[model samples]
Structures are given as C-alpha cells and as structure tokens.
Target: MTKNAIEVNNLTKKFKDFTAVDNLYLTVKEGEIFGFLGPNGAGKSTTIRMLCTLAQPTSGSAKVAGYDLIKDSAKIRQNIGLVAEKMIMYDRLTAAENLRFFGKLYSIPKQRLEERINELFQLVDMQEWKNTQINKFSTGMKQRINVIRALLPEPKILFMDEPTLGLDPQTTFSIRDITRQINQDGVTVILTTHAMTEAEALSDRVAIIDHGKIAALDTPENLKNMISQGDANVFGTKISNLTSELVNKIKSMDVVTAVAQQDDYNLKISAQGENALNEIIDTIRDEGGNIASVTNSNESTLEDVFLAVTGKQMRDQATEKATPVHHRHGPAPKARVR
Candidate 1:
C-alpha cells in the first residue's frame, strides 16, 4: 500500500486574471498532521479546494486517499471528512439529528450511525447537548456539532481549515486536543492556519506559502534555527546616563563589533560570538557601566518567516479583523473544507 495519503504535482488554479494557486507541488504522508501555512491570498484554500475535488485544477494532478482528484472525485469524497470554520448544521435539528442526517448521506449503516453519533457526542464533551436544538446552542456548541457531523463516516483523511478561528482560548484548546485525539486514532489530518503558534504546536511539518507559491517547507524548529543563525548578539545595562565617550571605549574592546545607546541610560553593544559577551561584561565592569540584564533579542519567530516571504501578516488580509485567515473568503467564493 502507498504510504502517502495525499499527493499533488504541479497543481495550479486561476481565477480570471488572478493566479490563486501557482504551480504547487506537495505530498502528505499517511497519518501525519500536515500544516498548510500562508498569508491571505496566498492560495492555501485554493490548493485545499483542488485537493478535495470541490474545484478543478487549471493544471497538474492530485490524489487523496489513493483516489485521483480528477477521475475518482466521488471516491475521494467518500474517504475524506471536512470541518469548516463556520458551523454548517441545520438550526432546527437537534445535534444528534444533524449527525444522523450526514451519516445517512454518507450511507453509513443505521446501527453504525447511532453508535457513531453517541461516540462523537462523548468525544466532543457535548453529550448533554445531543438532544437540544442546534439553534439554541452556543457558538462553541454549534462548532462542536459541526465537527461531529463531518466525522460521521469515519473518513480516512480529515481536512480542517481554521477549526478554531474566533473561538475563546478554552474552546480553542479543546478543539486542538480533539484534533490530536483524532490523529491518534489513525486519521490523516491536513490543517491550514495562519496562526503561527497553532501551527508550531500542532504540525509535524509546515509548508510556508506566499504569493501563490511555497517559499519554504520544513519542521518549525528547523525554520526557526535557519533564521536564528548568524544573528548579532547584543548586551544591555541599566537605562541611565552613559555618555558617548563610554560608548566609544566599549566599541574598542575585542570582538565588540559596534556599540550604540539604547535609551536614556541603557546601552546596546553587538558582539561577534560568546567570547564577545564576556569581553563586553568585563569592559562594562571596568568602565563603571552597571549591568541590568542580558538577553538575546535577535531571535526569529514564525512571524518573521511570514514577513520575510509574504511582506504581510496572514490575518492582515482577512476581511474580518477578528477572523483568522483560514476562515476568510471573498464574495461568490466557492466553498471547500473551510
């Protein structure tokens, strides 16, 4: 059996004059949580839509759960479950009813469907709300039901697009835990999010996309380390009355590349390496510059990666200021997982 759950080769999608997804190629291994990270208009959703067979690609090919995206769309649908940002359950129906309805649509046997509904309610910690009308449910409750509805068929591959967008911290944590549990049960997960912290915490590997193309792809730690290397080290002391003469003296020390005043009293000196750090400290003590704190301020984050590649925050382009990028869609946009 193939070890890959998803494979895309030179996948491209265009909308009139706009190239939504440029020639993109990616592979997701079976049972891995592959994170799709990108800014707004970076083509994350466009790629997901093409992979899910909701929209046809302008060029190239893809396969999901061993089903060809072009020729076996139905089979792909049968093996995949999609949970979008917005809850998509019928308001009038009870939570249990909503799950049963989608379960039937997937042709799950009646006995299995009932067992699945009970299991999902317990899984999401919403067993108490199972018989309650969805219209009366809170936003978090409704979202939980939406997730349950998507899992009705026990799909082999699950696609979650901004599953925790706009949710409270508690609710978001709960959702993250649920996702981990689902993956532990052997379901291959594809997650798309612009939230750097979320991607860092959940993803096994991340693909950073920008301007409809992938700029970098690797583990979060490797990406951080790549940017952290070759950074200048700086040391600081109390914010008070150090003069230009004192600054000039500090700069003359071995390995001290440069020295500049930070504020009213604080001074910033850049050094070549760890050796420079000790030289600066001894020089400061001899020169009578009282040290306050020392720290490495040049470290890079996922945000730095986004700015380096896309020149903007993923959430900055989202229409709703409060909504994460994975949930935002333009008018008349075709619906996919999220």
Candidate 2:
C-alpha cells in the first residue's frame, strides 16, 4: 500500500466552549494537490493550524508526513512547510533578506539555501526584484514571495492557506500554475480556499468542509457528478424584460421541474431530458419573453454539490463576515465568544 503523506482521523479542535474542527477524518496521498474547501470561518484555517502544529487539536490523532501530530510536532514541522493565510514575509525586509531568515530557521546549509532561494525566485520570474523591500511590492508580488518563503525549507508536504487569497485574476492564475508545478516536482500540497472554481480547477481531489464536518470528499468530476448523476439537472438562461408572467409560463412547461428568478431579468430553471433547454427556450419565446442571453448548462459544478449537501450557499457564510480576512477564524462561535 502506498503510504499517505498525511492521515487525519477524528481530529477535533476547540477554542473555549466552541468546537473549531469537529471529528474530521481525511487522508492525503503524496505528491497530489488536495483542496480543503469551505466558506469563511468553516473551520478551514483552524484545521490547517492543527495540521501544521501551530495550534494543537483538542482531541484526535494523526500523522503528518509520517510523524505523530502531537508527539512529534517538531518533526512534523521539519517535514512540512506552511504558507499561512497571513503573509509570512516581513514588510520591512527585502525579499532576499526574508528568504534568508526563513531558510536559517530550517537550518538549511547557507550555500545550498542560497541556490534554492535563487531558483525559487527565478521560477516565478521575479529575480530582478530580489533585493527590493516587500512593502514596496504589489499585492501579487508580496503573495508570490510569501509562497516561495514557505518552500525555503524544502519540505515534503506544503500547507497553503489561501495562497491566492486577495489576489487579482492574473496573479491567482500564476499561483495556481506554480502550485501545480510544485506538485509535479514531488511535493504534496494541501490548499484551503473558499473559491469553488479554484478548487475544481486545481485540486486532484477535494474535501468540502462545512460546519466543522466533511460534507463530501471526492475527485472534482465525481463530486460534480453526484448532482449530475440524474438524467436531467439545472440549466440557467437569462431573459431580457423578464416578468412574473414569463417566469410562471416557463415554470408551467413540461420540461421544467422548477424555476427560480435569479435577478430582475434572469431565471434558473431545472429540468430533465436532453432537450430540456431547447424546449424551455422555445416556450419562453412563444410566451413573448425576450431572450437576452441563454447559458445552457448541463454539467454540475462544485457550488451545486456544496448547496445540495449543506443546504446553504457558500457565499451566504462568506457575505456574513464583518471582520477583516486576517482576523476571521473558523466560525463566529469559535472566533468570538464571551
């Protein structure tokens, strides 16, 4: 049997009376990117803190890169690298200075560490800015350097807590590409993110975490197929000049099982059958509904799976957050309690 890079069994964490991570069980194979997905304060960061040994679990047992989580936390730290939700590099420090400081903590040989840092900087094509102070760098540049700092120790498993969080689309894609490149070089990575699209695109397998539990764990395709397993599913279409009358007419069609108005001019219609979309479109036009744009979606997405299992939109939890990103913890009960 192939040895898992990390194995978590019934792991749980509590801050005061609130349970942050609740009886979580998971296994991560070596050299594959595993995504831990959930809305903000869904225990994603707390779980990562436990796995990284930054915070100890209230109850549970596990091995990270073959060492015990509690008994050999130092050993685990030695074998694992962490890219925290908060940027790791010091703002006042130059990029090269920051790398050197982190490298020294791992006791990496100065000669070899220099080579590694240089290579990492070059990998992201930011070699020219090595001597520049981190504070002067753009958000994307700071995040990239933060990521490379985690790799300074040359660890076997890397835990990235939203490495691309707060980054623009271009920088987000850069982080994703670099993550894949790191996995290809034989480093197992565990990434935590709220973006379903990011998880679906990057993870080999995803664990949908919510309310301190695993809602679903499967390959992206299979997780999506869980909802798409039925013969027919939801297909969304946008209509111009949408009215209650037009919506009711679409809902009354034989092809449609359910219809919901997404916005003033958008409808999310559910149906079964290969011709479901076509039939709905024709019916709308027949009823004097103006067509603006029709997006005929047949495939189930990660968001669909999340909603089906949790009965809550991921964005619902996200939008409820009034605190800033860095201050936010797993859940409201966990983060703030008297």
Candidate 3:
C-alpha cells in the first residue's frame, strides 16, 4: 500500500479579520509529484508556510512527514526541504561556499557534506562552476544552485514553490526534468505553480484551490475530462476581416461565455448550448467576417479546466505586455476577459 507523505484535517489560518486558509483537508501520496495551483492571494503561500512551520495555523491540525504539525514541527522540518519562489542564497558566496554554509546549518558532518556537495554538483552538471561566485551567475545558473542547496539535507519531502518562475524556456525544461529525477529518487514533491502547462506535465494529481478552498482535485486528464463531458465547447478561428464591432457583437451573444483575441486575425471562443457553433458563425457572417479557418475541439486543456472551475483566467493578464496589432478599422483592441 502507498503511505501518505502529508495529511491535513480542517487546516485553517486567519488574520484578525480575514481567513487565509479555511478548513482545508488534503493529502499527498508518498513519492508522487502533487501540484497545488491557485491564483495570486489564494492561500497557497499561507498553507505552505503553515506546513513548513514558519507560521502557526489558527485552527485544525496537519501531519507532515508523519509528524504532528504543532507537536512535532521540528521533526517535520527535519524531514522536508523548501525551495521558495525567490532564490535563497548569498550573492557574494561561491557555489561551494553557499552549499557548505547551508549544510553546516543542517549539522551535516564536514566530510559527508563535502562528498554530497560534489555529487550534487555533478548531478546538475555544474561541477566546473562550483568555485564561481553566485553574483557572477545568470538567473538560470543561480536557480540551479538554489535547488541543490535545498537538497543538501536529503529531506524526504520537497516543497517547490514556483521553482521555474521567470526562467527561459530551456531553463524551465531543465528544472522540470530535474524535478522528475528528484521524484524518481524517492522524494515526494509538492509543487505550486501558475503555469498550467507545467502543472499538467509534472503532476500526477492536481488540486485547484480558490478563495481558500479546493475547487477540484484529480489527475490532470480527469479534470480535463470533466470539461469535455459538459455542454461547453471551445473553438479557435481566424478571420481575414476581424473588427472590434464584430468582436463586441460575438461577446454580446447569449451562447458566448468568453472571447479572447489571440492576434489580429485569430480568436478563441468558449461557449455552450447545442447551437453555439451556428450562432457564432452566423454572427461572424453577419458582421462581414471572412472566415479563414475554424476548429472545434472536444479536447480540453488544463487552462480550460481552470477557467471552468475558477471562473477566471489562470494568470494575471494586466502584467503581460500585449503585442501591438494593426486592425483595419482603428487602433488594436484589447482582448476581453470573462
């Protein structure tokens, strides 16, 4: 039988006037990658803080690594390693010096720690850079060192909070591969990330949280299947003569649930009802839209499930820089949100 790595029962955290995590119950299986996903300010950090023994819960109880959250927090801490979103290391220290510092704090023997450090450096293929100062490293290089620093203690469970945030595509893929390798080596991983693609690719089971509660919990494919079995349908299309007036008219349709303009020529639509496609196509035709192509797919993505469950976009679009487009009618129109 598979033993649980972490378990919680009605875990809650509150400020004087606000509740951050509200009566949450959850469990993570041993040696599996569990993805915890939520929007910003959605209690993910608070829950992690509580489990990591950095913050006290307002009520309820949890067992991390088979130790009571309150009664054995030190034991729990000893059995878990945390990789925070922000890299934690001294910029002035060389990679070897930083690892030695952290290993000493964990009370590892000098000879064993040195051997382990060398082994890890080789594992990440960074042995040649071990003597280099962190200040001289690029963001990706620094992140790699940060990850190895957390592993020095050889904890049973690893809590990775946005380990690949702000990384280039190549670095992100490298980090993800590293995560899989770690899990294969018998470490249970709990990953929190905003990237739905990352979550789907890495997680064996995913839990979507919103407003301090679990909105849905299952394997990524199962969650996507929930969307596929529903009445909602997603469509992608390109229009040769797309305009703001046509876009607005489609948005006003009773069948349309959400509309996003991908580029000057392309649009992604989500709608329900039996005649959703007909209604949408008729609207486009009425508005003098020349349809270049249309694709209706029953296959649902993690992003699609996220929207259906949370009723909001997965990431904050306001922070992303929109590409400038040349529209036939006037200035480029901003993409509409549900």
**Per-residue lDDT for 204-282 in model 1, tens only?**
8889888778889888888766545684465555634476667778767767554545576776555567677777777
lDDT of 1 at 246: 71
Tens-place lDDT digits, model 2, residues 95-204: 99888887776678889989999999987889999999999999999989988998888889999888888899999999999999988989999998867788899899
Candidate 1 minimal-lDDT segment of 10 residues: 319-328
Lowest lDDT 10-residue stretch of candidate 2? 319-328
Q: For each candidate, what TM-score against the reference?
A: 0.75, 0.79, 0.86
lDDT per residue (tens digit) for residues 42-135 in model 3: 7888888888887878899999999989877778878999999899999998999999988888888889999999988987889999999999
The C-alpha stretches of model 2 lying farther than 4 A from their native spots are 239-295, 313-338
How close is each model in CA RMSD to the real structure? 8.8, 7.4, 12.4
In candidate 3, stretches whose alpha carbon ends up further than 4 angstroms from where it belongs are: 239-254, 257-267, 282-291, 313-338
> lDDT per prediction?
0.76, 0.81, 0.86
